[model samples]
Target chain A: MTRLTRHDARRILDGRDRSGRLGALLDAAAASARPAELGGEDDVLTAFRAAPRHAVRPSRRFLARFVVVKAVIAVALLGGVALAASSSLTPGGEGSPGQPVAEGGRADPAPNTPTEPVETPTAPTPSPSDTSIKPFKGEDGEDPPEPGRPSGKRLKQLCRLFLDDPRGARAEKDYPGLEERAGSLERVRRFCERLLGEGGDDGDGKGEDPQDTNPSPKPSASHEDTSGPGGPHNGPQGHKGLSARSDGTYVG
Target chain B: MRPPPPETDTELSACVDAARSGDEDAFRALFRAVQPRLLRYLRVLVGADAEDVASETWLQIARDLRGFKGDFDGFRGWAATIGRHRALDHVRHQRRRPAAPVPDEDLTDLEAPSDTAAMAVDALSTDAALTLIASLPQDQAEAVLLRVVMGLDARSAGKVLGKRPGAVRTAAHRGLRRLAARLGPDADARPTDPMIPAGALTPRDAT
Candidate 1:
């Protein structure tokens, strides 16, 4: 017997079989419809009538799912953008102040001095300083004032008085303690000026006239001192000013 | 040995379109044309439960006919695909609740009903032929039934079976060769003999 090729099978399946025997066999095998098979025509027709005329089309279902999926994706993208924007903004705000504080804290040999400068700049009113003065005075009076290094309490007091009434404080009688802490009254005024600059506290605008006249040289000197290698004496005030300027630039 | 004339593609497509528009007679016409082939294919797949699965298949077809597209050939393939799915579902359902196994004798009797007195001989031969085809491997039996009984081409049969056209063709070829071998040489010896006459061999004349 010849082998049945795919082509012969295809021809026979398509009902164009040249060989009569295989075709006849297929015809006989395709049995006539029994009563049971045709009996369900009425039932199927009843189901057809019961089914909705137009419940839902497949394309319509697909389109609805597509829209819902797209909406979810769009909302997720917007949420991600909002979260990224807020996160990016917070780091910049924190890094501006934090970098200078970190640099100052890292470079300063005296960890205790850095906190004093941070507190002095934030105390814009005399009343807050007066409240803070009592604790310091009690703490410092126990340790007798050192000759070359004035106590922090005494320095803060002298700086406030000098800022309030510069002429009166400069007179040798009003703040004899400050003049005695230093060698002369001239040195006391210069010390107060350095303290105020380090504090960055020109907020009251009371005694800013003298400093404003020569402020350009001070900032340039401070900028040079800060930019140069390892000038820890002037670093705190320079760092504070530098951080405020950077914060302004970032916000704008 | 001749089968009845099958519906032409034009008439079948017309019936499908009209049935989609809720024409009852057209739907009945489509049911008459497709039900026998569907039942035959399902009998091979699910045995005695072919009628139940075919009913479920038609219900789904009736409900989803509005969503169907393509011509009459596509409609047949679509119906076959639905029938196959329902048959598989019935098999799975049976496996889940396997209370008692029906005997082979009862299954053969159920397939060839004795009540059809006029067509008893034809039904017996048809049942024997189907039983013989079903005894082959599952893929070969499906390939033969879909290709021959359902009158689907290899590609259409491939779509219904979820196989590639080449694989379907090869399977159908191997199945036909196996069936030919099983039928023996005497059945094939007179293929070109003039005893049957050439006019009777034509597909149109078979009707």
Candidate 2:
């Protein structure tokens, strides 16, 4: 038997083989049509009918836009949360400076009580102290001689002394200047009691100064007290008396 | 033959264009021309599952037709490519080699005529011829089937097999030589056998 050449094979594959046997073999292979070969034609046509004319693949632009939108929303949400957190934290820190002062007052009562009385005695004897206390007295005093508008400094001093030794300070000999400026011993005690109560309860003493003036409408009594203390005492006396009356009105 | 004369390239190109435009009859014509060839090619790769694989192949072809761009020859190559992919997928899924070629004993039962005159007159049965071709090594078997049985040129067959045209042609030549040797001396001796009419030996329409 002769060997099949590349030429012969090409011819046979091209269906030009006249050499008979291999051509017949290829013919038979091609001719053999099983029913199953075309059986699914209907199914294929059905699939074709259901297919979209131009199926949509997710384009690059659409995907990029979607990602950008998501990123924007995420950044906006984070920024809003950060802004809210900073705004909330700032006021909370600034608004409560009073807490630390109140805590300090409670924590060092021993030192504050002793220092306050000594400071008060030294303060009233000095002319320099009187000049310094005058501006504060003027700013705080609304009535000329009413006891409702005392300077904060003087009221706090009297409160400390009265609270320390109310009976001792009430005696005319021990603090003659203080008793005279306060109008009477009983009034000094009452004024000191109100100052301590309001200061302790309010915790923020700096914030309570304006509020203390609302109740000091007893100018007639303060005028009488100022006239009795005489000229040298009038300025300081009027200042202290007005403050005491103011504190009284506030307490009342 | 169930299919009419093998469609000329222009006819197939027209059918593809019509099918893309939703012409049902044109799509049916395209299926008729391509399915049998796809089935026979797949059979060499996937055995009994060729039918299922071919069905999958056709479904893909139908759906993706709108995106296709080529002449009829290109369409054939495209369909064959889809079939080859689906066949390999089936083989991997099943985790087995192409079902062993019809056993030697089964081939013996077909009693393929040894005489060139008898072969020319009666022809080997389609199943028997395919079994004989399948007996060749896989590369040669696929080369012969794609080139001869599927009516693809060497370049198109090479595209389907992922080989160069030269390699596919060589494989096909070797396969035919082997098939000739198997058919024995008489079949090989008569290169110009007078008994076989030229018309009778022309490539049969697959569909």
Candidate 3:
């Protein structure tokens, strides 16, 4: 039926619980958050011990998948070896029995040609964030021009491709606090991908507007509030503080 | 409370290392340090189901201890997260089976405090205090318990409640204000809260 302003309450309880009669209640409740003396610690410890060992044993699904992958590689290797042997045998049997091993290797190049196509199949794992584009893969698959040259759209495309390459992911794995950097880089990559009309494996990225282009929000988009307690304009910053704190909830 | 015994954070870190090596005493020290505050937070969150939820929480903590990657502060937040989840699940179960009676043995078995005169007074008032806390609105109760009781900074408490820190601060302030009101106008004059005086709450921020 009655109300107290937050300001009034803060001023009153500013120096709390000196004598200990009432302050004891909040303290006691806070302390109660700790483990009780019910000999429950032992039981808890026992239950914890019962959890699956924290050993880095790979999951069963990973193991099964690894086995399958290994099996496919083995079969491919065997097929290549068989093709190599038959090509060598035919070179000796048919055209020139006296021909050298290197030359004979290309005598009936059908098997060797087929093996090229087989090896190319390995490129199809379909990563969502793959950024490698073989623009110079005509025949020699030569590297593109060096980055020192400044130019038009080609340069920007190259930069985006380089940043988004899977090598960046491997490099990121080694750096301690690179996650934030990687996130921003990924955003840029996604932006570039959209610019080039490249469809991403990420499903939710397709948010309508095929031609309506939007810029990637920079990592520094968040405005950090330096104001400590409050001021006359304390109203707007009120909501942002709570949302910032909530970001830390899911600790690993 | 009592400035967290000065050596607490360092001692906790050391005990964690020793406990990971399977030292019983070290593990007990950790359990002693964390259990009280953890139980208090859970009590407010899930009421009588606090002990069961706490048991589940500790089990998860023990299992995950070896893989944990932060200081004592991080450990508290981590433990609190697990405890909050367990408490939520217990609350959900209670909702589905509202008529089911909570098993009473857990609360019946709590080891009483050794400091007779102070905690004896504390015991009675604290019980009354909990009753009063449970009567507060749910958000207010959680915000107050996390800030005033569990000693979490507003930001950390916000994470546990999945709220923003500003929201947590407002909620806590409102809850305390309401609690002051419920104490029948004399609560402020009744012993005010000092920063971690003698028993129970620890200022982990101190260490």
Considering only chain B, report the TM-score of each candidate against the true chain B.
Answer: 0.84, 0.75, 0.76
Residue-wise C-alpha lDDT for candidate 3, range A46-92, written one tens digit per residue: 74555335332123334534544554554455445546646776443
Candidate 1 on B82-146: residue-level lDDT in tens?
67655653443333334534334345445434575656666655655665566455677778888
Candidate of highest TM-score = 1
Error of 1 at A38 (Å): 1.9
Candidate 3 residues lying further than 4 Å off, grouped into runs, are A1-24, A31-38, A48-252, B1-7, B17-24, B103-119, B186-207
Off by over 4 Å in 2: A32-34, A54-252, B1-6, B96-124, B187-207
- Highest lDDT: give the candidate number: 1
lDDT of 3: 0.45
DockQ of all predictions against the true structure, Cα-based: 0.10, 0.11, 0.10
In model 1, the runs with Cα more than 4 Å from the true position are A18-20, A31-36, A54-252, B1-6, B108-116, B187-207
Per-residue CA lDDT of model 1 for A1-252, tens digit only, reads 666777788787777873555665676667566554576788888877765363334344455455555545544544454466467765534433322234343323233433332222111222322221111111111112234554566666666676554433433232535644543222344556566667775623434334322322322122111112222211343233322322221111
- Candidate 2, residues B62-88: lDDT per residue as tens digits? 655654545566667667766765564
* Recovered native contacts, candidate 1: 0.28
Against the correct fold, how does model 3 do in TM-score? 0.48
Per-model TM-score, in order, reads: 0.52, 0.48, 0.48
- DockQ rank order: 2, 1, 3
**Top-down lDDT ranking:** 1, 2, 3
In angstroms, the error of model 3 at A83 is 22
